[model samples]
Target: MKPSNGSTVSQQSALSTPSGPSSASASAPLAEDDPEPRPAVAALPRHVFSENEAEPEEGRTGDTPTLVFGVPASDEPGFREELLLPTYEALRRAFPDHRIEWREMSKFDLILAVVKREVDLYVVSSGFFAYLTHGAGSSWLATRKIPQASDPEHAVGGLVVARAADDRYATIADLRTARAAAASSQSFPSWTAVLGEIANVTSYPEHFLGKPRFTGDSGLSVVERVLRKETDVGFLRTCEYETLVARGLVHPQALKVVGERTSEALACRTSTELYPDLVLAARPDLSDSVRRRAAAAVFLIPESASGYAWTVANDFRSVRRLVARFGSAPSEHAEPSAALDRYKYALVISVLLLGGAILYSVSVSGVVARRTKELVAVIDEKTTLEQTARVSRERLSQLERAGIVSELSSMIAHELRQPVAGLVNYADGLALYLSGKQDPVVEEATREIARQAERVSSIVERVRAYAKGKSDVRQPSDLCVVAKRAFTTFRSGADLTGVRVSGEFLPEAPVSGDPLELELLVVNCLKNALHAAKSSPDGHGEIRIRVSDDASGEKWCLEVEDNGPRIDDAKFAELSHPVTSEKFEGLGLGLSISRVIAERHAARLLFRRAGERGLVVTLLIAKRPVEAEDASHGTGGMNGMDGTLAAPKAVPASHYGADPSRNVLSDE
Candidate 1:
């Protein structure tokens, strides 16, 4: 917009005005003929800005003139609103006939929006205003006047802070190895001013402190890094530091000011030269009445208004001087069309040079390309033949191993059967004789002999089935029955002298698997648990076998826990691999074979530490179909003495293990 003298005033021209006196800096004297000052503090309705807020309805109609003010660039979304809400309220009251609207956006976005005429006014940093006026141009309407308590003059300084306990750095020169953090690269006091001070000492300023970390856009965020020891030092605006301490956001004694710059105008400790605080800018074409009213309304916002007040716009030459010295502003001299025109000749020469080289290279390599393709095809064919030969060799090896296992199984079955049958016959005859004698000692001996015979016969049957290549017949069986049977046999017959064995069977734990195989799995786990417990530091130890559903209720767990020395986490897998046992006199194949059986039943066998002193082995299987329903009614089927049971239709079963108090099954 042109002035009354018919000359257009650029943004630079506006900022070039003589510096206003510091006392009148809070409220620049507007036209002498404006309205008298109203009370600075006025109460008004508050509106919170969020994604859910309804758009202001006051300016929708064409009758009331609407003015939109853009928020400044700050890390915090609420920084501008918290400080400017009171000022906005005052403007609404002063211009009751008009509508006032606030638009929230980032610093860079706000600059672009105002320059493009998308927004009418903006609260921006002095450095930003200077950079804008240097190129795209800006119109200065008013500037904020923070109190001398918060800010001494129109300018604010940069504060460099380090931990109070850190004694390595007393000044900026001592920051050679220190890591630096700041609000952002765009912040003047946090970044540009500090850079200006370092540039005066050395040309390569990075040599002084390496690269600085832009921690975040908020002053508080950068300060937090220093206090948390995440960074060695922090830089932020002097006013920001004072304000944080005043508001109890941070404690003053926690941080020490380094390389403190003394300024009578500055009421707080700082490190770098002070630059102007945030300034208010407006579009050059804004109507005179709106501009005047806005300028007046801002000045009326009182000190009790939470530090909200405006002074005459200060000459922002200090900001320009710093920016020009440090070369911090983005390039503004390039025009795409002019740049293209200037580089066209060089572009033509480069394209011509590249085309000639490509033509020569293609002419020389045509035959070589064809030969290379032929070589690659021959190599691929050879690779394919090698892979096929390797597969054939592996198949033949597998067949040979299968044949050996079959022959071995048949021989074992044939050799073990005759002795097993003879042992059973002899035990039966002994039992018959002992029954007539009715001697308790002879009767017990005969019973043990019969049990051993039965065990031999069971092994013979299992070997015969496998020798004939017949898979074990799997049937829906109650696992609780299988677990109890195995526990009863192991506790009665195994030589566990000092070690105590215990079992808790949850009834109706149904699973689909071979009952004999499941029994073998349980027996091996129990025997191992007994051995481990006996070898533990206590010498006399306890083993507990538990059968229950998992937390998910979809899986069942058969867990055997023993009070044994815990295995380290790194060697748990080694226990499952076949290795000769140091304690037992055979290869350690019991647990490994049990794992195979578990896989056959679509289950997993896992070993883990139980509490701090023992190991627990768990076999996880799919839950039975009716398990959940039975649990709700407080019933898990009854215990059938025989191991054959599909579903339990009765009450829960009893515990099955040898009593520790009894001296039966001694090691001797």
Candidate 2:
């Protein structure tokens, strides 16, 4: 998942990067010499693995428990075909007392299946497994030990490549403006790994990579994109690249590896240090016995065309950290370190001078000799660049933290200005009234002074709470009362013409959470909606809030709808993430904080495009069961048997899984 800076030492390039057959065959890679690829999975009966032809008779008398194995569908049609549609006989022999069923799914669906207990185990890449572990609490049961030719260990690396003729891409620094072709966004080698490497060396990694085009689902697609010049650079897992070359699908000299690094212990060329390979992880509820039995059977699977055998899982902390670095939200105040900027200018000059010398030499020598010389030059330059990048990375980390603090200080000062000014004005008015002997005006000024003081106190409290990462004091309360109070507070601030704000609340909506926090969440959403409606092209808008039970009848839904400009898909995807906003004012932390509050309440916060005109944000909360004592107090905490509010359980990913097409946050 994460890329590495491995050392690249000079040698006969040919010796370091072998142009030989895969370990599987000397003739060709995965050709007719190998077994025919399994047929594609199609419509199947519910219990596809029920056939008992290969099941042992001794275990037939007992009740049969079914275990479902899930496999995420890959773009390479044949990659997962054999694994998913393995001969039923093999599964029967391996799991004789149990029925084995296979489920092919998309990534999102696969995660949901695990969360909802639809599948017992799933085979996934290390990067995706890390994502599940962080986002859904899934854990690994076992990992596959691929062939030495495939990985040499439980880990695998990735290769970043460019056309052999393109001389500009000599190092990671030279890849600044290059368009990249990657596999799926979730892919470790082709996407996450490449991103991690670039991010280490650059301040704005997104701009450096120039918006990569997701080619397809396989490593071969990356090669094809590079060869066709659809992308300036390409990324692939090391083994996949070598296998393609061995099959003659790609020419050995057609492409040059970027950041090419050689390790004596590594069997293949790589641009990144190896990370843990694919793994078989289990759902949270899978029994230890079943997990052990499954792991044992998978280890017994002899090496086949897939070039893998199951092995004990290695520590995947490195891969998890790698993903965390890339997925981390960018600091709004971040800038390139001064040291890096200085080095970059120096690097550019050196590259230009070296290129000029190489061009002159090429003119004297024949093309063949020039090509070999250029290869050596590139290798040497990349090694130097890597060292420079390492230094820059160290400086960048220190400077980044300082920049964020400075930016936050400036924002806090800006926020304090309004209330401070109001307080001064109130003080001046009171002084004038007292000097003029106007008692009535002095009384009014005193009240105004109290209000301004409270406003300042409130602002300071908010800043302190955010700094300390504190959650609100929670209790069982009525959702409708919180919504109404929040609506009233928001209405007091909204001074717009031709904008109608309306709310339809159900009679009773009991929820177990902080009332103040719930009110704040509602206020923030309403405030954001008002801003959107004000910016409507038509200059007229309607914002509506409705409280009712969701279609599922299990959760209470708070839907906020607005008639404003439709947010572009790209911006919509990042709504819940903190960033500087172009349309809304302040620190751009409102929606992000709202998401946090939603999480604390064990609710789902979703944003979706409402038809062709505006956006709709829905908050789905688990309905709280009301007790007899709850009705006694109009707005007090729930009095359950424990004399405290029931702790909220987080809604499973299954809640969002039902219809992702309608919920943008669900995809994230």
Candidate 3:
């Protein structure tokens, strides 16, 4: 609507009418007929212009601002009531603490108001910034509006008519020929826009329509009269048509398009097309920082009121297509016309980004799962191989012991050969003496030949015991009886060899093992002790073999300790090694095989130095009670006739050896 004449440019014109003396600066007062005291604050910053400073934006937060919004070049608001809140509500919702100022100004003047700080900020279409700064040299520090996320906009356009009655105006072509009810000459919908914009003049004669019907009001009101059937064909925005139609007040079948205008900012509908409708500009002189921030805040307002976003300092190239598409023909929006259109680019980028995120997660999972499987397999195989290796080592130990014993048997046989040869010579002498006559010495000679044969036989038996590993032939025998039997049987040469041999008779410590094997082990040690003593001329050491029960409540141990010599740990260990003697005169097999037999009977052979001098060889043999004591008397052999420990008749000393060192070292 036109402002009151007293408040418009008429006041400026009348200011020049006063003929009083005037200063060269034209600073003269206007005619004072309309007198109203202007408030002192009116000349101050807050009162210079009014919108934001006059009311609270919302929560009344910071300084109250004066907000002046640029008017759309067109008169219609396109968004439906469902989406668009009134401007008052939009400002309240955005700045809850501060009041917002509102104004209706020309789009270009709105830009100047903001530049002069006469307004806080304004919202506009995309290319408005380009217009202000194109050659204005202020674009360097400006911020442009472009959304980072998707947002939708709402906008509409208008068509004009001379009247609303379709009966008189069957179509726009018919009305154009009659008369027109156009907007002001400078209005986009009015006369000047016919040639397009306020500068161009074309299309109608001044008297072509009845003396121009002087409506002298806003463009929207002129269109309203036609809808009321007061005029013929005229122009307005499509948003205006939809609003009246939505309020159940109008119908589209009542009119037809006889003319159209074009723009790069508006979308086309089957009903009308025109310039894109939006706030098109803001002032350029405000600090670039504040201008940019306030522009963004306006866009942050609900799209229901202002549409998608504000154009801060954006150039025009981006929106030209949208701008070019707008016109005054009513039509539906067209389908996509190119791959690089906004919607297409958005869809392609979205798919690529989503696919990349999914592939990244899958790759990480695949690597972790594969490594777990590989490590698990390695651990399982290592455990299985270790068990197999342990079993293999035990079996190898047993084989080594058996090999040494077989080799030792042949050496022992050679040791006994000489005694048997001497027995033959002695038997022949006794036979010759008895055959010629019964001499008194003849009986004595026969007894000596028989003793020689017994000595040789005992040596042979001990060697054979080791050959069999001594595990099969077992009997219940007292450790003491076993010791004594070996003593009497091989005790014949003990004194002659200066090897005193004796025993501690712990008769109750009975054991169950091969009788011969027990004798071989005990006698072998005793014989070794005696020989060691005999080798010393100053030696008076007695080989005292002891058969005793260990104090450990459940065991029987045969301890044979001698003072013959002090043996070292190395010699003691070597004595039990399988092939140690294969390279020496001592076969070393005796102790090793004895230990094997001991293990079979759940026993152990413990050898160590004893009494600071001699060796202690103990047979920690496991025992069982003897049941058939009547025949053997717990000795290992049959004996009873004289209540004495009767040794079997033995071979004699006629088997004396020249190389004593080559003797088998057997004392029984």
Candidate 4:
């Protein structure tokens, strides 16, 4: 009787088959009431071992060995059970005392079980068997025989299938850009075998099929997708199309095999070189006697019982080669080992060269460090030389300014003498007229007028003396009073038509300077502002004069601003020093002299372009303490001379239109 569960069968019934009544036949007599006495059931036969065939060690121990057979879980539904049933039944008949157990697991788990010796034997694809033989030390017992194939070893391969109606893919190469489907990426016959064939024809086998979709576990789905136009091509196991057609699961005319190869030994249409079929392999640790018996039992299976037979295929060289080419071979490490051995000398030479490069880098770094230090010393020397040159330039500039001042002094003195004489004549006439009238207010005003005329003469004489290198004393004076006086004087002399002039003055803004020179500087700035304002496009202009002290009381400012045509920043920057005047009918001496007087008072002259239009000229000076003026009265002033100012430094010759060759100062 066949095993009910297909996993285990009792040895008693297996041994008693055909020799005695079955249990059903014997039990039927027990249920009968008719008294025709049944002849006694034939006694079950006992087998005896020959002298050369010793009893199994398990039989001696009275414990049956359960032979576990493992199959891949990825096999099609019912394929595992059907494939192994014949072998299971054959093993039961051959060893009546042994037990048989069947197991289904993934290919990876099945390999692990075999390697761990958890399963005594396993049946897996030839590709997996090749791995087991080399990696897990499994011994091949038999290779499955294709019933119609003349050669068992050349029985299996992959098929590239496409819809018969689809003329787009007639061959494997034509399917490169076509949408392709496969059973699984891990399926050997469905994917790897096809890939191997493509690898033979092209260097890039992975991309030959373009990106194929993997339908789960069975190639039938891949065929269905191809027929439904879901995919243009499908990869299937060899004979899978024919098997589906025979089973009525597929219409034979619906799909065609691509790149089909014909072999007298193989009956199926295959696109790849035929390799060995599924293998029954024994674990390395399985007993030799049991392994031999199992192999014999597998060989004894009648082909009629399972429609397939097991045969010993000594040549799995083709399968092994495919596994190696696909990089799934257990001996994959051998390739890298051989490469390393071949290049060992070159590797050593490269190491030596790298070491030399590192040493050279270290030496070069040392040289760079030494060179950097030398460069730093050279830079320091350059800086020191630049400083010396700057000092010499300043001294030379001072001499040039003095020479220019000396050259202009006579002309300046001549111009001022006439103004001074006119003032004196007017003052005398006013005094004479007042003497006759004897009005007290008029007499005081005439005396004040004469004093003012005397002060003008004194100022012109002092300017000429200063040009000749005489030191005039500086005294604490209210800058606000000076600026107010300059503004009043400018307003009196200049045309006031179409121009508005205003002043913002502090009550007291004290600074140490020659008061006459300070007033002259303010007057010059006011004159320039008035000129700029009058040059406005509209002919109507405004000028504002401001005299203020900082909150610290240590500095004071005189600012004169005008609304006129906007001066470019470059031109305004040039105004910081006295440059040639851009105006018509004007000498640039006005600003040059103003700058000199400002320098003598230790003040800075700054020119800035006002927003939208015009220029703002500012004189920034350090404020002098009130006590210093009293101290100065007891002693000499800045030049240690009473009532005289210190001689000014020479200005750059560039400012005075002197010979450029003699100007040593850089514009910077």
lDDT (CA) for every model shown? Answer: 0.66, 0.64, 0.45, 0.68
Candidate 1 structure lDDT: 0.66
Model with the higher TM-score, candidate 1 or 2: 1
Question: Ten residues in a row with the worst lDDT in model 1?
Answer: 37-46
How well does candidate 1 match the true structure in TM-score terms?
Answer: 0.40
Give the least accurate 10-residue stretch of model 4, judged by summed lDDT. 25-34
Using lDDT as the measure, which candidate wins? 4
Per-residue error (Å), model 3, residue 542: 20
Q: Compose the digit string of candidate 3's lDDT tens values, residues 78-116.
A: 321212223334444554433444454654454444334
In terms of TM-score, which candidate is strongest?
A: 4
Model 2 residue 173 distance off true place after TM-score fit, in angstroms: 2.0
lDDT tens readout by residue for model 1, 420-469: 78887898898886688879998888877776676666666666766665
Model 1 regions more than 4 Å off: 1-47, 51-65, 73-83, 93-98, 106-117, 149-154, 247-251, 285-289, 303-307, 326-668
Candidate 3 regions with alpha-carbon error over 4 angstroms: 1-404, 411-415, 419-457, 465-477, 481-507, 511-516, 519-592, 599-627, 633-668
lDDT of candidate 2 over 1-668, digit per residue (tens): 11011111121211122235453322332222223321112211011122122332343443557677777655332334334344222454566667665566766466456555577777777876776576555667667555544443435767898888888897877888788887766577667777777777898776787778875446666676777677899888766776666545466777888997766545778787677777788876677787677666666666557555556666878778877666321222333342245358778888999999999887767777878899989999999999788657744653464457546855785677577667757776766657667677666767657555655545455554646666454456667656665676676677647787766767557877766667779988888888888888898878888788899998989988889898887688667554544654566667766887899889999988999988998999887766633653443334231223322222221332222232211111
- Model 4, C-alpha of 285: deviation from truth (Å): 1.2
The TM-score ranking, best first, is 4, 1, 2, 3
Off by over 4 Å in 4: 1-63, 72-83, 105-112, 164-168, 175-179, 228-231, 305-307, 327-477, 485-503, 514-598, 604-668
For candidate 3, the TM-score is 0.30
Q: Candidate 2, 541: how far from true, in Å?
A: 60
Cα RMSDs, all models:
22.3, 39.0, 27.0, 15.8
